[model samples]
Target: MFENATKQLRETVEAALPELNTVVGWRAGYDPLHMTPVFIKNAGDLSKLEWSPFCVQNLSGYLVKDPAVRAQDPSKKIGICVKGCDSRSLVALIQEKFIERNQIHVFGIPCRGTVDWRRVMKLGPLTGIQSARVEESRLVVEDANGGHTFALEDVLARKCLRCAHPNPVIHDVLIGEPVTPRVAVENSYGEVERMEEQSLEDRLGFWKKELDKCLRCYACRNACPLCVCQDRCIAETREPRWLTQRVGTSEKFLFHFIHALHLAGRCTECGECERACPMEIPVTLIKEKLNKITLELMSYEAGMDPEAVPPLLTFNPGETGL
Candidate 1:
């Protein structure tokens, strides 16, 4: 599947290179087992592109950063590869007027699931595994001792299991044949629902317990492709001091609240924030609850279409659905 996808992706980029300034996709990292975002300027570099479960990072964030290409030649388009959630971010960006639709050439991939490296590490202590590969929906782990097989579903990130739109929501060219959408289950926000049922004090205590483990790494914010506002982040400011830099329960609570509030209507629920956290915080739960509120109160879903405006962006006096 990856081979065919890679071939088609390379061909697409090669054909579009004359009109595009850059083609962004996943390239193998210094460690062959991992993948990193690769920006290809020339057609010849397309051969370096690859895709797999390890290609989990959202590339949409880079679109807003291509100032050099845009400034030098605003008409020249940029090519990008996107999974389901990443496509939504593209749509959201377009809706928010962050980027023009014509400025991007999107190649969409139907993602089955992505691996959680931390979860994989938990299977056993580091055993010198040189590389890992996916074959027939099973992970093939290779090390000095040989290969072992583990069911892909068992080790896949939890977000993937609950994912509804595995196929890109928007795309100019789709690489692989689409698969059947899994049965829509209510489990996606189950954890958040359980938390909601707890008393206010209990819920606060629950979050306090989790936030206590935080080292204030800001990995969640950094990993988020939607968190484009880096210059004036509330965490770093001091004039007004919206949040203290000191690592404590008060500061952590403030951080989480501001983070969730900022992502109220814009979050695509990509689960990158949770995946990137070294402490394994359930960051998506907060985003999921916000999503539920957005749906219930405003009847809106983020990143479904480039033309669809977010409810929070507009005021409707008659809107009282909740």
Candidate 2:
């Protein structure tokens, strides 16, 4: 299914090239289990683009972070491909006017789910992967040794398990047939639901232990699609001195606090932050709790309506539960 979708994706992008200045997509990374972002300007580079469960990075952040992409002439339109969750980030960017709808083309793909490399490792001493493909009920892997198969449940990302939006919300050109969402809109908060039942101290201890493992690498912040504050970030600002160069549990906790608060009513829950963490911290849980708060207090879901303002971005005097 992915191979067919990949073929059609390349064809569609090639057909739309005349309308776009540059197209951003994923290419095979250094290893078989990886997929890295690439920019395509001509048809010759289309081979660099690939679609698979390993294509996990949310590419929308590139529009703001890549100087060359942003520096293009106003008349030249950019193109980007988005998975279901990634489209929400794009929608948030559009709602914030960080990027105009007319300035770019969107190729939306209905993601079944992305694979977690760590989960795959737990299956066995797996390495030297030459290729991988998803079968009807299992993932087939080819390596220097031989072919192996594993249940999809053993390797799927936790975010994909609870994904409420598997089909892209917005797309100028959709690459494949729309897929049914794995998660229902009403039951999207299951992960955090159990955590919420814990006592206050237990909740505090959970984060403290997690933050203690943080290397202060800022990988989580860097990977976030909506974290547009590149240089002016409070984490490194000098004049304000929001955070010192020190690395400690207190600093880590505070840093996460800032990160999660800034993303309130804005994060698309793409799971990039957690994936980027070298320490394997469940950082998205912080954002999940924040999302639940917004849902319960304001009845708002981020990135659902591009024209509707984020709840926190707008003031409502009648809103209670303050």
Candidate 3:
């Protein structure tokens, strides 16, 4: 499925090159099993673009966070690739008016899910990764030793286990056929529900234990496409310091709180924060809790509807139960 689509994508980008100054996509990193974000300016480099389960970065962040994309001449449009989760983020950006829809050419692809490298390492070491491929329900990995097939269910990212949207919500051109979600949305919030079922003290303990492992790397903040204030983030500011440089459990908790609160109704649950964390923390859970509140109190879901206003962003005197 991906084989044919990859060919089409290269052709499309080649054809669109004359009209675009840059095209953001993914390329193989140091290893065949790993992928990294790349920006292509020359047509000859279009062949470097690729599509695979390893293509996990939410490229939407570039649209707002990268000065180049923001400062580019409005007459020329930039092209970006989006998967199921990435597309929702693009819509959220559009809803927030961070970037106009006409400013980008979105290439959407239906995603099954992305693999968590850590999970894969649990199967074997990261060294000598020769190649990897996704077959229907399994992943075939070949390394220095030999080839091994692992059930996709065992190695997929946690967010993907409950993905509500497996197809792009917005796009100018779609790279592949729309895919059916691996899991239903009705039970998508099960992890959050399970956490809620825990005693309040247990919940507190859970976060405390997890956040204590934080290296204060800010990988989560950096990976977020929506965190536009990163350059002047309050976390690092002293005048009205919301968070300090000191490393402590209280500080870590506040840091996460600030991150969650800022993204409350805005987080599209792209799982970028969790994926980027070196500590392997479930950082997406923080945003999910806040997202659940907005869904319950205001009947809202971020990034699902570009035309709809966020409940917190607007004041509705007619709001019934506030």
Candidate 4:
């Protein structure tokens, strides 16, 4: 499946290169178990493009966050490869007017979850990996020591396990067969629901404990596709003084909570924030809770429809059903 999808992706991109300024995809990172975003400007670089469970970074953020991408020639469209979750981020960016539909050519690939390298390493440490591949719902890694196997479920990212949209929501080209979602949208909030069962005090204590582990790196903020505040971010601005450089649980709580709040009706739940966190904090959970509340209160899901305005972004005094 991986080989076929990658072959088709390369062929498709090769054909579209003439009409694009650049194509953003993935390539093997420093190791076999990791994948990093790659930018392809010509056919010669198409061989670098890869599609696999290890390709986990949400490349959509480059459209809005990268200065080079933001300043690129508008006449030539940029090509982007997106997974199920990443496609939603693209839609959200379109809805927010960060990027226009015509400005991008999306190569959407249906995803069957992605590997959590941290989870894989936790199960068993590996170094000098010669190769890694998914076979029959199991991950097989080959190294100098030989082959190691792990159940895919045991190493998949938590968000992927609960993915409700395994097929791209928007796409100009479909890369592979569509996949059945692991969970229905209505039941996708199991983690948040489980957290809600705990008492307020327990929840507070839980957040205090988790937040204390924060390194104040802003990796979560920077990784988020909807966090478009950029240079004017409250965390960096002393003009408003919303946050200080103090490194305490309170300070961490302030930064994370505010970050989540800012994405209340905007978060796409692509799990980039959690994935990017070097501290291994489940920072995405805070935004997941907000997304849940937004869904229930407004019966709206972020990034599902680019034409629809976010409920919180507009006012409707006569609107009922709350």
lDDT of each: 0.82, 0.89, 0.88, 0.92
Which tens-of-lDDT digit does each residue in 114-150 have in candidate 1? 8887777677454777888888789878877777677
lDDT of 2 by residue, 185-272 (tens): 5688887999989999999999999999999888999999899998788888889787777777898999999999999989889999
TM-score attained by model 2: 0.97
Candidate 1 local distance difference test against the native: 0.82
lDDT top scorer: 4
The local lDDT score (0 to 100) that residue 126 gets in candidate 3 is 49
Model 4 clashing residue pairs (backbone): none
- The lDDT, on a scale of 0 to 1, for candidate 3 is 0.88
Tens-digit per-residue lDDT, 36-120, candidate 4: 8999998999999999999999999999989887787789999999999999999999998999999999999999999999999
What is model 2's C-alpha RMSD?
1.2
**Cα lDDT, model 2, residue 260:** 98
Tens digits of per-residue lDDT, candidate 3, 180-295, equal 98765556788899999999999999999999999888999989988878778777888887776778899999888888899999999999999999999999998998888887
Flag regions of model 3 displaced more than 4 Å.
Answer: none
- Candidate 2: the clashing residue pairs are none
Better of 3 and 4 by TM-score: 4
Model 1 CA lDDT for position 25: 94
